[model samples]
Target: MARAVAWRLAAGLIFGISTAASAAAESFDCVIDPAIVVKVGSQVPGLLDSVIINRGDRVTAGEAIATLSSKVESATVALMTVQAGSTSEIEAQRARLDLAQNKLARVEELVKRNISAKSDLDAAIAEAEVVKRELALAEMRKRAAELELNRAQAVLEQKTIRSPITGVVIQRSLSKGEYLDQDKQLATIAQLDPLFVESFLPVSKFGSIKVGMPAMVKPNEPIAGTYEGTVKVVDSVFDAASSTFGVRVELSNAGQKLPAGHRCRVSFDGTTD
Candidate 1:
């Protein structure tokens, strides 16, 4: 009985040591990739006037990256602007209304003095009402012109393509003078500031890793440094065949010193690769 007790104690000590060793070697293979890749395109079809950005150029969100041929659109905007700003028609109608009102007042006075026929007074009143309607019609036309100007400006704005994300341009598919369609891609951009480190962990680590946990990522030799990252995602579904679950870590690359598309290793226990 004494010998059996000693054997069980030794085996327990061996199992505890093995578990500690496995926990210490928790680093896993991972790959550094861009957080998002976008294919930039124009909203309207036109001939490309110019491409403001080239491959490898960093762009900010809402920055104009490309422009399409907009000569006709520009002219339309200018014409609409002039029409909207013109007050000649409105002023002429107001003048005509004033003359008609003065004629009606004189005719009313003549009728009161018994010098003019009632039919003459009625004619003057009808003329004044017609002029008032013409003035209103002119005012309505002016409002319509203003709305048309806004529509023309909006159509012109669609000719300029802007970047939806702040990132580096990776590819330029269309060049100046090329025909661009709404369905065609003009360029490719990748967001790298907040890089993603993707890795798969054994099923045993399912409950051990959680979102918001801190991690250390070390890229392969060419990039020699360790980056601190935070656990962004942990898969709830396991890969039955591999008995592994995927994890995503977000690493900040403020200056973008690190390039993406490299293999790396990550550890959650504050260890280096």
Candidate 2:
């Protein structure tokens, strides 16, 4: 009985040491990737007037990346602007209304003094009313012109293509003078800020790893230094064939110090490979 007890103690000690070693060596192969990749394109189809940026250029959100042929649209905006600003018709109508009102007032006074016929006064009143209506029509037309100017400006803005996000241009598909359609890609942008480190971990380590846990990422040689990352995603589902689950860690790349697409290793215990 004593010998059996000793044998069990020895086995238990060996198992404890193996468990400790496994926990210390909890590093997995990972790959650093961009947060997102976007295919940039123009909303309206037209001949590309110019591409303001090229491949490898960093761009900010809402920056104009490309412009389409907008000569016609610009001309329309100018015409509408001039029409909106012109008040000649409105001023002319106002002058006519003033003349008609003065004539009506004089006719009314003459009729009251029995100098002018009632029909004359009636004619003067009718003319005044017509002039007032004409003035109102002119004002309405002016308002319509202003609205048309806004519409033209909006259409012109659609010809300028802006970047949707702050990223680096990885590829430029369309060049200046090229015909661009909505389906055609103009550029490809990759967001490097807050890069994603992806790795697959064994199912046995599923519960051990969790979201919000701190991790250390050591990128393969040629890119020195280890980066600190935070656990962002832990897949609830496991791969049936591999018996592994996926994990994602977010590492901030301020100033773009780290380039993506590098092979890396991740340690969940806050250690480097």
Candidate 3:
């Protein structure tokens, strides 16, 4: 009876050891991604004048995307220039001020010689002061108008909209002649170079991952050469429902052959040598 009991105990211990080893070597499949999605939109409201791109069109930075009609902006600038006064008007104002000053001088000389009454001299001084105020007011109004004209010109400049980043147009929302509001979305763009693949692992694997750690990523049918990347991020918190942790890996897509949203295989080092 003692020998039979010993044999049974040894068999149970061996079974438990095998189960732990199998669990330690377990792995999971994950989906990959580009890690970013950029949305493009209009800065101000206007009728969509033109669209230079279509869906899936690749564009470089600073390329013109669309343009609004410039006629309205041009007209506003012209009106402001007129209100700011012309060089000729400024010259005329200066001449009037000089004439007022001469009249005051003549009145002062006559009053001192007893050829004119004190009241006449006082009236001339008051007239000169009034002319001075008028000239100053005119100059102030001219400056205000000049600033307005500058602002209108700046708005006109923005009518030519351009892209800020180099990427492919994934979606186009507005087209020519469509009325757009300031908050309207114009398009969607995605960067093509240096793509990233997104994946998640069980919380048990999170502690072992670190940024800059070497990894091997292969799609189910991967490219000929094994693509390499460094573990870019490991999530700080574990997902309660899924009981998993998020991770990202950055990889170069210089040729853009490896597209976003494609399925890929990922392998990280499980232990130190």
Candidate 4:
């Protein structure tokens, strides 16, 4: 597989010194290559609650692929949410503050009319200030509770694994109810759309192909589609043995109608850079 991928890469970067081939409507052997393949894994470890994806499944970016046991985390999140949602603590503090303010107001009027002493007004003012400070403290606690709830929710999200790319699931390494260790791989995914059509041309034609030039790709037996592709690479280095330059073509594979690894032939028109 690695050699095949390297050969495909060479198709785009072929460099040669010979009076090679023409850039006309000529054909060269090629192979379909996947643009990207990834082995998806998890960041944390836990018992696998479920594996929702299997081989041959089509997944979108950010789709939930699997999940770990999150019962405890869910319960914690719920508890934190309730605590964060509760406003009784702040409400009680606010009530006390209001009462203090009313007492201060009454004491001030009474003192002004000589019905109360200055010490009573002073005491009432102190009580109001204390209640105001208590209210501020209560508000801070509420904010702290809310922040904790957010943290719990974030942890819960991590317990559920999501796909990082939109692609096809080619292989799955895990099953539901299995113990998934930390950083364990769960599945392999591959992006096939806009598949790479890599091919090599004679060294002499090295200077003829230009990026963005249109070409035709003909897949071998079993794959009967003739796909249109664009020149994406033209290498300037020569392979010691083949003495040929490499050229790469990119073609659209919408709906994955064409499969990778199939042998193909690519044709380019008599257009040079």
Candidate 5:
């Protein structure tokens, strides 16, 4: 009986040691999280003319993702452009001012030769001044028209929605033929590269984990093997209820060779503060 009891006791000790070793070897559970998520939308209200992209489509920043029915806006821009380029009114006013100046010169010569009355010269001077003022007003109107054209062009550009980031289209909210406004959504986008791995570690191990530390990230599937990860964030505050601090690691996914939002495990081989 004594020998049998000894064997069982040894087995229990080995099991306990193995369990402790496994737990220590594995740090914590991790989730692959996207560092960039964007919701594309039009800045101006209009009829949804067309959606240039579909779900699962890859897009680059500044690329046109969707457009609005902007015929009115386009017409307004063209009209303003023409009006801004037009100087007919200012030219007409300038011609009148030149004529008034010529008349004033003739009147002064006539008065000096005693061929015209002093009142005639005064009348000519007042007429020239009035024409000059009118010419100034016309030039001011031309400048105001040019400013309106600039505003029109800006409004036209706002009718189209552009991708703010290089990412995949996860959803299309506003489709073609629908009316879009500030309250409407256009699409959902998520950047896949440089993915982030989020996890929480016990505060006791906080002394051992540090930002900028190298670690290994193993994804579940469709992305086998280990990818290099760099520790990016270690929360300063601890969760009192769980006694854990959050940690974040970044994984470079250039060319988007791997998928995002997958379950992964991070192993900090020799992480130490």
Candidate 6:
């Protein structure tokens, strides 16, 4: 009887331990977020000629937003071309070549008749050759001028600024006719449509999360309903600073209702629970 009682007590203890462990292993909820703010700036510099879009305006990729006044730059390009076409040096060389050719023809005729000495004919031929070289050099100078004109035209084109990515204009720093430098931050753009909702995954959940997994986001603010997204990226390396790996979920906000930098909860279906 004593042995049986002892065995029963041990079995009850094991059952209680198993039940506690199962309760501890139950799934729970986690709030998702890796919020980031984006900025915008121009790659080149000039006077701000136009500001087409205002703050809070949504923009598409490769859309033109602002531009620098290119009138003066365009005129400079035209002037350089004119200078190349009508330079005095080129005209002078052409005239010299024409005179040398005429003189050489006359000398050759006299030499055939033996009226002009051979040495004189040779000297005239040498003068013609020198003139020909000068004409070639003049042509080379024109080619260089043409190259300069092309470069000037390219710079003039760069004055017009365009949006780098599809996003919304968050801020505008300059107005029309404002001077800007190459490194200046002209505006700020945040991708709202299909914006990325960054979140953290604990080390324990690393094996469960994978690319293409479905996710649901609930913004803290008044969004219409739960936003759907997919796991776009999973960090290969752990973030030592946070003791969590990073995961990115892409959600669309075509209506511009989901504002960037909003805190949100991300729920993974079936996989997490």
Instruction: Go through the candidates in order and give each one's C-alpha lDDT.
Output: 0.94, 0.94, 0.78, 0.86, 0.87, 0.77
Candidate 4 overall lDDT versus native: 0.86
Name the 10 consecutive residues with the lowest summed lDDT in model 5: 264-273
Best by lDDT: 2
Model 3 per-residue lDDT at 168 = 82
In what order do the candidates fall by lDDT, top score first?
2, 1, 5, 4, 3, 6
Q: Could you tell which candidate, 1 or 3, scores higher by lDDT?
A: 1
Estimate TM-scores for all models: 0.83, 0.81, 0.68, 0.82, 0.81, 0.65
Can you give the lDDT of residue 79 in candidate 4?
A: 98
RMSD of each: 4.1, 4.2, 6.9, 11.1, 5.7, 7.0
lDDT of 3 at 51: 82
Q: Judged by lDDT relative to the true structure, which candidate is superior, 2 or 3?
A: 2
* CA shift of 136, model 6, Å: 1.8
lDDT of 4 by residue, 1-273 (tens): 999999977775563312254434458889888877888887779999999998999998899999999999999999999999999989999999999999999999999999999999999999999999999999999999999999999999999999988789999999988888876789999888878888887887777789999888888887775778899888879887988888889988888888887888888863221
- Over 4 Å off, model 4: 1-23, 233-246, 270-273
Q: For residues 87-181, could you state the per-residue lDDT of candidate 1 as single tens digits?
A: 99999999999999999999999999999999999999999999999999999999999999999999999999999998899999989999999
What is candidate 6's lDDT per residue for 2-58, written digit by digit as tens? 999999999999999988766444433334332333566666877888889899887
lDDT score at residue 126, model 3, on the 0-100 scale: 90
- lDDT at 84, model 3: 70
lDDT of 5 by residue, 20-112 (tens): 777655756788877798887777788989889999999998999888888988999999999999999999999999999999999999999
lDDT at 228 for candidate 4?
81
lDDT of 3 by residue, 70-159 (tens): 789989988887877566656677788899899999999999999999999989989888888888877877888899989998998788
- Candidate 6, RMSD to the unseen true structure: 7.0
Shift in Å, residue 81, candidate 6: 3.3
Which residue pairs clash within candidate 3? 33-198, 218-265, 219-264
